[model samples]
Target: MGADRGRRGGRPVRVGVYVGCGALLLAGCASMPDSGGLSGVESTPRQDAQVRVFAKSPSKDASPAEIVQGFLEALTSDDPQYETAREYLTSSASQAWDPYRSTTVLAEGPNAEAVHSGTSEGTAEILYRLSGSKVATVDTQHAYAPDSGSYSRTVHLTRQKTTKEWRIDGLPQGVVMGRTDFQRNYKSVNKYYFASNVSSETGGQLETVADPVYVRKQVDPMTQMVRALLKGPTRWLDRVVGSSFPTGTELKKGVKSLSPDDRNMVTVPLNQKADHVGQGQCSKMAAQLLFTFKDLTPTGVDEVELQKSDGSQLCVLTEDQADGIASHGTAHYPDYQYFIDGKQRLVRMPSSGSDKQPEPVPGALGDGDKKLRAAAVSRDESSAAGVSTDGTSLYVGSLVSGGSLGEAVLHSQGKTADDRLTTPSWDGQGDLWVADRDPKNPRLLLLQKGAGSPLVVETPSLDGRIKAVRVAADGVRIALIVEKDGKSSLQIGRIERGTKSGEPPTVSILELRSVAPQLEEVTAMSWAGDSRLVVIGREQGGVQQMRYVQVDGSTPVGTAPSALTGVKEIAASEDERLPLVAHSQEDGIVRLSSGEQWQKVVKDGTAPVYPG
Candidate 1:
């Protein structure tokens, strides 16, 4: 049982709930995508997008069961204001109810059963037990995290003397629905933030980090987005990313509807706390807002104007101005997708070029003098890091002509090639990361600027040895494959950095959470979008398969790539427009573009990669 919350209620007439005949009927299902492959059968939306559900107001002298059923049905309707849903509650309960505090998603529609709890003031009372298997909870921040266990909440209803109707007097905060209804009502949007400590070292350029959240698809998304942005990033990302908005900043008093004006600009009137920020900090806040609102629509908002509490314009930021303040990984589309050809040398081909012949890069790794086993290219495409064929040596050099691969920068003393160094990866900061899997001394190392002594990253909470590591483009988060007891699962860890000047920055991986707990083994994965990853793994006793999992552990619908066999390495770009590339043992390098099947890129190539 959960805590008792909210106000009293009365039983009223129901609209579409018909449980007496048999099983409960579900209405207002959302239309699904055309591709039709769902992460799970129950998770897919079934409502027609064109069909709008108009909830019916409660009727007089409704039963307790009818009132409870009607409100649950109303929660899933398309009635924008939810006026009909409120009709089921008493006047005081209706006024006190807040449906958006949070949303609890269950594996199926909640089952409400009524039992006589007691009576007060010569009126009968009934307690409705709402129960189901909990799947996830979308917090007030709109963040989603996987959950399990049974859910039970008691809703106490009392009979009214005036109407003789049984209305709920006490209920839990927030709405509760099944997975299908959640899929119909809410959508995922990326909220952006700036990377801390990086601009301090790189001269004041904020790299944007995306924090994804779920919001109602049809409601006033602009206003909801603004409110969420003001609250700050989600808890999982709070330690690593920084928001430009000052603490306690909020929408100005009496400011609710925040639609873009006729001039295509959104004027956000903020409280007194945000009124005194400097121009640079103000622009950074507006830049984060702009990036966050981009997910609302294509043309809803082009500029953001921050207003003081007194309605004075504090600052206005256009799209171009916002870009100058912060850089998303998509600022420059990559020129090529790189890989090691049959000759064990680094090579590249145009990213969008169709079946073009691969060419050796103009670098030491491509000079045919070094037989490499694995490699990584800097985000800017200016440098490359390669591991020797034996996997004991790691070499970093320039990617331009005349660039030389000097002595090996790092070495591993693992007994075998498989136990040496994992494939290296570069972050947007131009730093390199790799895990040394030596049985004698295992460590996760970071090469600052791909040079100097490598720094061993601290991971006090890691229970297993690191199998593979992929740093996110923002450098605030990392995707790690951890192996323990012969199984490997995918985990995301926040990269926290120290700020004291002169001393080497203290870097540690904190709050590690498993994003694919069901998978028995995760062989390879890459950042596919702002907070999504393309993962290659399979469940226990299951066949190998590939799918996309959100950093927060929710599986998105209709976006999984086509199935492939024997995938040794997989690569995806933060720029979601690019196709997914993978090196398959049977098919060599293959690519999967949207709405298309996997196409072969080569017959013998291996280790395909896109510049981070």
Candidate 2:
């Protein structure tokens, strides 16, 4: 929710036409073979992922600059082994350099400038500075993290006595490439895990959380993804998500590849670390695999079979069985998109593209005299939470009719509406979360099952008061609009819950980092995918914009939501198939159906929201 000002702040690759072969400066294009219903790490027409990069060996008599440039270019290629990139390096450097150590993505192609030139023991010694603005980095685990700053590295080259050719003698570990090239060579994939801190007594909804990472697009992505999953979640998410695989569990030694069998099941052979696990834990591990692969190998993958170190069956889990172990939200379809209407009544419309008159939900929020300023429906649509018009009270009630509205479950002491409570949000585990904007005692509160005493969530790292809050359906991550110094930014934080000895479990919103640092102020945001958020904000003093940002703070490669004006509140379903619902000042309660413009749903409606 924000000022009326919106402000605020693909198709699979075609086979063939792969990288061209030959000894050119940069490697020619190449393509990967489509196998087992996979489509070469699918990309849209605009993305060059369909085109493979070929690394070119340094030309004869190449200068130090040329050798460094050739080697850097090779790092961006799809070559599985990066052999060509090694040719430009001295024999010892080649063996010591590890391209997979990490990837430092820069704002643009690096600039190489001669930093030093001299002679050491009659052999020509030279050094070039490769510099650019660092945007982010992907670690060896394929996890991504934002690391904004200047990036400067020295590439030392030497003239070999025998060949009299310049070759790189020393360079920083890991590959460096521009953002465009990084996206071309890598694709984001979600590694799944169980929510570590959610309440087991609260219906025990074992849910899977998304831990996104970048993997080489043209490599054996299925295998890479499986390996990443087995390695556990990214560092930031490691504390909040639990992996079923035991520590040190990994693919068996000498097992370098994995493929789906004729029955559409991918068999994974694990080392002894996973051999002693019982049926329950092993099945959970398989569930993690099936969840990660469902979207990856969409067409053929139906099961995940785990084999022990000696090739004996440990456990096998089919997609159907995994669904029983954890709720991934893939099967839950949102029933309706909801909002507060003209009379301040919580109202709803079918999620499908229907423009008929809206109806009030079957609850106190819908029919009671109490006026609500905003509301959040549960993902299952069985319950709803509403914030009073004055933003002082929060109420959670079932969607069923005839239920009486209980006293305010939460309240804020702020005297003004703007200083009171922002919109409240519901997570898949049936818990409700809201932030009180009280100037004297700002706090983020959580209520289990929407009742009982409100628990103050620990947010040790939060810099400013939270103006808005939305929890992902997975119950592991949260999107927050933080207001500070007259500007608001979108931050993605890890939601952690832990139970200490003889005490109730505690919850904390940890590591609140802005995902939309480019936006001067973020007006609204919603979880668009497992690790992506659709945010509405604008560059400092610029027109407001809407775009998708990875939880790791990287802009996604895709078309932004179509332009709209005066978006006060926005609602989106995890099911990308649903139309986007927004409360536009220009056209109240509008819907952006797939491939269609925003259509007015109701006049002057406010606070549109889909279930979390």
Total clashing pairs for each candidate: 14, 14
The worst-scoring run of ten residues by lDDT in candidate 1 lies at: 1-10
What is the per-residue lDDT of model 2 for residues 518-572, given as tens digits with 9 covering 90 to 100? 8988998887777788899889879988888989888776688999988877888
Off-target runs (Cα >4 Å) in candidate 2 are 1-51, 201-205, 298-300, 500-505
CA RMSD per model (angstroms): 6.7, 7.3
RMSD of 2: 7.3
lDDT of 2: 0.80
Model 1 per-residue lDDT at 89? 78
The superposed Cα distance between candidate 2 and the true structure at residue 36, in angstroms, equals 34
Q: What digit string (tens of lDDT, one per residue) describes model 1 on residues 349-431?
A: 88884778889999788988999888898888999999999989999999998888899989999999988998899988888
User: Where is model 2 poorest over a 10-residue stretch in terms of lDDT?
Assistant: 1-10
RMSD in Å for model 1: 6.7
Name the candidate that leads on lDDT: 1
